[model samples]
Every structure is written in structure tokens, then in C-alpha cells.
Target: MSEVITDVPTEAPSEWARHHAVPTREAYRRTLLDMARLDPRIFCVDSDMGGLEDGFGQELPDQYVNVGIAEANLMGVSAGLAHSGLLPYANTISSFAASRAAEQVKIDVAGNNLPVRIVVTHAGVSAGHYGPTHHALEDIALIRPLPHMTLVVPCDAAETEAAVRATADLPGPLFLRLGRARTPMVNTEPYEFRLGEARLLREGEDVTLVATGPYPVVMALEAADLLARQGRSARVLNMHTIKPLDVAALGRAARETGGLVTVEDHVRIGGLGAAVCEAVAEDHPCPVRRIGVPDAYLDFVAGERSLLEHVGVSPERIAEAACDIVGRRG
Candidate 1:
């Protein structure tokens, strides 16, 4: 079991404990509900998503709005609420939010520079059991290019809460990605979560494993351990914030490590891998290998773990990629 962090309050519930695992969406819900109680401007807007059913809707009825399955209108209504000086947390599935409501998100929220927090759940292939239609393989590709958009993919429940609380007062639009199931805790010790800052999880010299999202980050850590057994030092970086890419950290990794293997649940086209490649290519030249879903859509449906393994995002694959990079550099 992982040790609990000192930074988290003693009086905090067990869910906040570093070792205790919880769903990222649950953390978002609890944190948002607490914030809503203190701030009158905060509102929970759901598009047939049941995130606010626990308390935000039942206890604080006035602060919650259910738009009933309309993803586009969800963005429009949230944007309108933001325009009226209200902080709206729009909850929806990642696939629908990015695909169906792409226009509203691009125009209504990002274009106007509204402070609407688009909290999308079931990010990446976490909802793979529901098939390709539910998989959010291209969400980052669709939303990352929008102007004034802050895209964040938190690693676990703890970081998800931190991101939600940290970005409460942030300017412009925000896209917060979350997974559907509970995940292992990435940070077992006290650490500061600064937006757009890459948190170095493990130190190494041979290669760097930069990853985002819950499973990817976990797999990166595991891969680092696997590499250690083989006398290979693999640096692990939890790149929670994708949009404002941490070039300083990447630069250091490129210069010091000489190679980087980016891991993510999304596609390699415009997701975290692409972002890292673009940053390193322009500033610090290095061998950056991307381990993510291919450009083609998955035709068959399967469990999240099965899908992840099929796409070569497991700890074994990540470790092998790191070893290959280290060998090539030698």
C-alpha cells in the first residue's frame, strides 16, 4: 500500500487518502459539490450525465441543471451561464462532448473565452466495452487546437480533485478528461499540483517515460520499475496538463535523457504524444517514440484493459519501448 501524503488534511475522508483508490469522476463530483456549497456562482450542468445525482442535484437543486442528452446544447447553455457571470461545470461523455458538440465548444465556449469547465468522463478507451462510438480516441485531437482552451488529463482521483479546485478561478475555457473506472493511485507522497507543470515521478538517466491519463501514468511507473530491474534508468513524468505543454521539463529530458517515450490512451495523431513531439522537435531535438492508439478506429468492442493491451500501452510494451530507445542512443 502507498503511504498517505502529508499535504492532504487529516480530517479528509478516506477517498482523499493517497493509497485509497477511487474513480476520477467521483473525485470531481465530491470536489465540485463542496465548491458549489461555498460559491454561489458555481453551477453543475449535466447532459444526461449522472455525476451530480449524489448531492449537487438533490441537496443543491438550484445550482444543478440537467439538459437531458443534448451535448451541443450542453455547451451552449454552459457558455450562456458563463456569460451571465456563473461558473458552470458541464458534465458529459467525452465522445459526445468532443464530437457532437465540437462546434459549440469551439465557438460558444473557447471563441468567447468563457470560463466554462468541460468535465468529460470516460476519456480515451476507458469506455471501450460500449464500443467505438463511446471511445474518446480523438477528443484531444478535436479540442486541443481550439484557442483559449486549457486541456488537462489528471492521472488519478487525487490529481483530478486538485485539477478541479486549481482551475476554478482559471481564465477562459477548460477541458478536464476523466476515466470511467477506479484506478490505482500514482502519487503516494505529498506533492504540489501546479497547472501546466509536469510532475517528475521518478528519476533516471537512460530514457524518459512521459505519460498522461490514469492508466498511462500507472503503466509508466510500472515500466520504470521493470527497467530498473534490467539496470536501465527510466525517468517517469506525469504530464497531467496537455495543452500548456511543459517545454522546460521536456527540454531537460531531451538534453539529459537523450530520448523520450510518450504514453497515452488517446491516439498518437493529436494527443499527448503529438504534443510532446511538437515541443521537443521545435526546441530540443530528441528521439521521441509515441505509444498510443493508432489512427484507425477500433472496430470491435472489449474491456478497457483488453483494449489497452491490444493497443500496446501496457507496462511490458512501455518498458520494451524504453529499452529500444536506450539501445538506439547507445
Candidate 2:
């Protein structure tokens, strides 16, 4: 389990530096191909997504399996492959993988504690125009409770690649939640990444903004900058790992910062915000504000950005929530 964990300053460049957004899904596709080249035991099973199948299938056809819309069967086969001493990566849409194939995931994957990596794309509302059926609002809620299921939400393409590489030898069920949007590289500089350890992007005392997933993290950094303009010092934490719940970082933020603001692209109920509140409630209780999609289904919106705005999880909304929390505490 080789891991790269380093800290870099998240500050604006003096000159005009181009920071390109990397799609985590695309990163996963590339990383998978690279890993498979060295490790023959690594097998990729897709539920008709065709990206992995097209990319790796051309080179290593024997190591690729396309289950053709049968998401449940995809999990079952991946579990079987894992049992046969093969590392299986099951790829599909988040909603289908977490909801449609949930039973197989629970009994076959997590229950057995197999080394199966369930890589899901279009998580949360990143599916854009696909609407609710495709939107994976409760993926964390559904997967978090399962025994031995390690949940991860990478902040960007680079982190996603590092996560996929790091989890190669982790001998248990893992879920990698990814967005479809091309999120800007928040950690443009090289940094070390550790499983279950929260990365503090910026240090401040006014308020703490904890974010998960790709777009939410980018938005969190933006929200932090927005707060800075108004004379509020905001700390940003990219909580990529959700299941382990970095309670130490959570406790420190609560103790040092004025208040806490958790941002996630998922539903507000059992998402990142809920996880942060759960951790803080026991050790360090504070004015914890949660920003995410509401409990109701997003019926009025169509595109991803519109749906996110409707739920008040946009950058501006998150900044307002942080300011409001700081103001109330003051």
C-alpha cells in the first residue's frame, strides 16, 4: 500500500497559472489501465459504461468483464473474482451501483469483506440533466452502514488517481464516489494522501469549512476565499474519506475555529455534514452548519449546477452559511 501524503499551500499564484480541472472518472479510467499493465490479477468489471471496457478491453481483454446493464450481477461476479484471488474493480453509475445492486453489494461484497473496489461515477448530482433517478443522493447513507465498507469521496482527479493506487491492496470492500464534472485542481501542488486522514487545505481561525467529493471541495476553497474578502478567516478541510470520519481533525476544527460548516454534494441527512456533526457531537460540540441537498427530491431542476443551486449547496450558499455560523457564534 504505497501512499503519497504531502502538504502544499493553497494560495493564489503571483502570475496567471492555468489550473485545469480533472474529471475523477477519467482519472480512474487511466489509472486502472496503468495498474492493470503491471498487475495481471487486477480485473475491471463494468456495467455497460464502455469507457473502461473500451480503454483496457483493447489491451487486456481477459482482465475485463462487461456485465451489460446487470449491476447486481456485476457485484456478484466481482465478489467471485475477488474470491479467486483477483482484484476486481466494479464500475457503474452511483445510483444503480448503490441502489439497484444494493443487495448483492451488502451480501456478496461487504458481508464477505472481499477486496472489491466499487468505483462509481456521476455520484451525487453530477449526472447533470439525468435528474433524480440517476442522481445518487443516498449513496453514502446506503453504503456507510454496511459492515467493512470503506467509503471514499476524492476531491479531484489527482486525488482520485492516488486513492485508486493506494487502495489496491486494501483487503476489504471499498467505494469510490466520483463526480462527472471537470473540477479544478485544488491541490495543484503535490501532496501526500492517506486513507481516513483529512487534508487541511487552508488554515484559519474564523470558521472551518469541511467538504467532501470533488466539486464540493473546489467550492469550499472558493467559499473560503469569499469569506476572506469579508474579513473572515476560514479553514478548509478536504475530508475525502467519509467512513472512518477523521474525528481528530473534526475536534481540532471545532475547538480552534469559531464554528464548523460541512459541505457535500449528497443529501444533507446522512452525508458528509451528518458525519462531521456525529463526530463533533461526542467530543467537541459547536455551532455546526450543514450545507447540502435537502431531503426532498430535486424535481424542478434539470442540469447539475441548477440542481445544486436549488439545494443551496452552491459556493455562494456555502459561503453565506459559513458567514452566518461565524456571525451567530460572535
Candidate 3:
């Protein structure tokens, strides 16, 4: 069994621990740096977002280039690098990288099916204090519809590191959605990273909680535990990959569980929730309750946890939703 955090610390010993229990972004940078050292074709283009002293920018100056806050140009430049037989990884905020540079991304990268890795940070509402514009709640909706686009959202730091390394050989345009803040480690045990396979974190029968991204997956696990306490069996699936979803796992969950509850940091319209519903409805036809951000946007900025709770995707709410779904099965 994976090492479950038995004692939840009320007070964090350090500020770094408080904000970043597991530093996913830092892990991404470090992994990229290590990979770049071995691969001569590895190059990085940043939209004035990557920290100067981190990753490619500082360590490998020749392989890194900053496009001065221009998202569209960033994609364009990365496309050029890809055309020159270089494996380029583009770094930028999720909203700007997806929405601000949509046209360029479609034409320059995805259109030609270039082997470029577009690693987007601050995905979903993880950009809490930055509010709606920075909160990429619709990034999955935007990228998943494009042809040749592969979307991967890692659940935690370990998965993020594994996913980054896994993208090295993956073909076509890959969109990696990464959260802004620290999250608790979920995949503590060693496991192989597959592009389209979903990991079953916990097994049960009464209900299934399918979730992606760090916070939502953790919430789903907590919800499963809560359901267990009430004598209900709830399974948890860490659906790390958003595109090319693990349909086989979804079918199994539907066959075994009473229903499925999809939890995500993005809106219910076109993220993990919609993807789960789409697959299950056509293949298995199971009852699915989509728990996430509603149709409206958060106008004001707040802390990540507070913003998530305000939008009603909190762990407590997820547990309640699971209870409702399982209760209706009777």
C-alpha cells in the first residue's frame, strides 16, 4: 500500500512546507534539466514565465530562449525549433498558453503534428489569487478538441515528474497541465507511467470517484475514506491523462460501482467530468455526478483552498456527493 499520511500536521514546520508540500513545478524544472543534459535535441522556449535561475534558462543558456511575454510568438518560435529537428518544450501559464495563443498553437504546432511539449503551469483555479483570467478552467476544453493534441494532467508531484519524463518519446503536440501550488503526494509507491492508462488508487464497489489534477484526486481519495466510514465502498481512480482516456477502466468502474462521481478543478462543462460522462454514457451508461466549478466564474481572488471551497469542489462536498449517488442506487 502507498504510504498514507497518517498524521495530518495542523501547523506546518516551514513556509515552504505550508505552501508546497510537494513542489510539482520545481520537479518539472529539475527533471527537464536532467533530461536536457542527455538529449542534445532538447530545447525550451519560455514566454517570460520560467524563472530566470531555474531549469533551462539558467542551466542551459544555449538551449533556452525567452519570448518576452508573447504567448503566440512563444508557440511560433517553439514550432520553428521543432522544425529544425529539435524537441522543444514550451513553458507558460495555462490560460495564456491555451487561450492567448490558440490560433498559433493550432496552426504552428498541432497542425503540423510537431513533437513539441507544451507544459502549462497554473492550470485550473490553482491561480487562485490571480482570479478568472489566470485560472485556466477551460484549458482542457480548448486543447482536448484539437486534433493531434494529447492532454496529460498529473495528480501530484511524483506523477508530474513521471509524466514529464514520459513525454520525451510521445509523439505530436502534448499539453501538460500543471497546478501552481504544492499538493500532497498521492502516488507514493513506485509505478510505471503510461500515457493513456488510469491508475486505480483505491478499490471499492458502492461508488467510484474519478478525478484528475492534484487537489481533486486528493479530495476524491479523502471522499472515499469518508464513504468507507459510513459503511459504503467507494473506489478512487486517479485519471492523470485527460485525453486518450482509459475507457477500459471506466467500463470496469461502471460495471462494479453503483455510480461515478467526477471531481476536477476545472468547470463541469468540458474537463475530466465531461470526459468521464462522455465515455461512460456511451460505453457503460452509468450515473455520473460532475462536481467542479459551475458555469459562473470567480470574480474576486482568494487563496486556492478558499476559492476551491467557494466553487463547491471541496473534499467535504465530494464526500456528500458520493453519499447521494450511492444512496440513490438503493
- lDDT score of residue 288 within candidate 3: 90
Using TM-score as the measure, which candidate wins? 1
Each model's TM-score, in the order given? Answer: 0.95, 0.92, 0.92
> Cα lDDT of all candidates, in order?
0.89, 0.85, 0.83
lDDT of 3 by residue, 1-330 (tens): 112222423232122222335656655765677688789889878777746335466678988888888989989999999988999999888999889999988999999999889998888888788777888889899899888999999987778778888889877889999887777878756678898999989989899999998889988988888888899999999999989999999999999988899999898998889999899989799889999999996898987768888889887898888888888998
1-330 in candidate 2: lDDT tens per residue?
Answer: 111111212242111112435577776776787788889999999888855655778889999999889999999999999999999999999999889999999999999999999999889988867666788999998899899999999987778877887888998999999988676777666667799999999999999999998778878998988989999999999999998889999999999988899988888888888888889999899998899988886765476667787778888988898888888888
Model 3's TM-score against the true structure: 0.92
On the 0 to 100 scale, the lDDT of residue 245 in model 2 is 81
Error of 3 at 49 (Å): 1.0
Off by over 4 Å in 2: 1-20
Report the Cα lDDT for residue 266, model 2.
Answer: 88
Could you give candidate 1's per-residue lDDT for residues 81-157 as a string of tens digits? 99999999999999999999999999999999999999999899898888888999999989999999999999988
Model 2: residue 220 alpha-carbon error in angstroms: 1.1
Candidate 1 Cα deviation (angstroms), residue 144: 0.6
Indicate whether candidate 1 or candidate 3 has the larger lDDT: 1
